[model samples]
Target: MVFFKYPEQIRRVMYTTNTIEAIHRQFHKLTKTKVRFSKQNNLLKLLYVGIKNASTKWTMPFPNWNLAVSQLAICFEELLDATLDL
Candidate 1:
């Protein structure tokens, strides 16, 4: 399969959809308690604050990230080269 072509480290990162789902769940939780917003900007501000707080918790980098990047570069040499050129 196409997925099997990548290294194990890359595969692990690829299967981390739960992290995204957790962020969405957190966003829902943050908005759920607030029934009404005075203006559209107020709702936006709340979401912006939520994002900022969530980002702070993401300080940890992926394990073996350099190895994953190396594997990805090998798998998509042309693509990475093109991106780096721009």
Candidate 2:
């Protein structure tokens, strides 16, 4: 797999679980203060608010994103070209 071959720097970019973990941490932080939710809707609302707040902090582009995309395109040139044709 290309995943096994990529360098550590590139691997981190490809593996986005870290970003997801951060978002989960933010959600946990928001909810940990409260012991219980009055209703499911209230919990949903809180999560929605958390997502909005988290998304705001994502304005900056990922480091080396262009280089990463270029490398990915090179790795999957034929597949990408085929998809573009469709």
Candidate 3:
């Protein structure tokens, strides 16, 4: 857990791969029934719809986001500010 070096608030934000894994699982579920798509757009559209449906449940905000951002700003002061125009 390389993220362990960060504070608890930041660790919670960084530690989980669940969201990405869930998205992959959704894509798998969407695509597994078909061996081939006749057109590239069809596959892309399916994945896009799957992502849209999965993202509908993402209404909740992360906890302690401001604190985590402050911590990140301290740790990556020059990089974060320069990247985000903060």
TM-score against native, each model: 0.75, 0.74, 0.75
Residue-wise C-alpha lDDT for candidate 1, range 1-86, written one tens digit per residue: 99887888779879863577768877898999888998999988888898888889887888887887788788778898788552
Per-residue lDDT, model 3, residue 66, is: 88
Q: What lDDT tens digits, residue by residue, belong to model 3 across residues 4-75?
A: 788887777777536988898999999999999999999999999999999997778887788888888888
Model 2, span 27-83: residue lDDT tens: 999999999998999999999999999989878877877676666667677776677
Whole-model Cα lDDT of every candidate shown, in order: 0.82, 0.80, 0.86
Q: Where in model 2 is the C-alpha error above 4 Å?
A: 1-3, 15-17, 78-86
RMSD (Å) of each candidate, 1 decimal: 2.8, 3.2, 2.3
Task: Return the number of clashes found in candidate 1.
Answer: 0
Best by lDDT: 3
For model 1, what is the error of residue 81's alpha carbon versus the real structure, in angstroms, after optimal superposition?
2.7
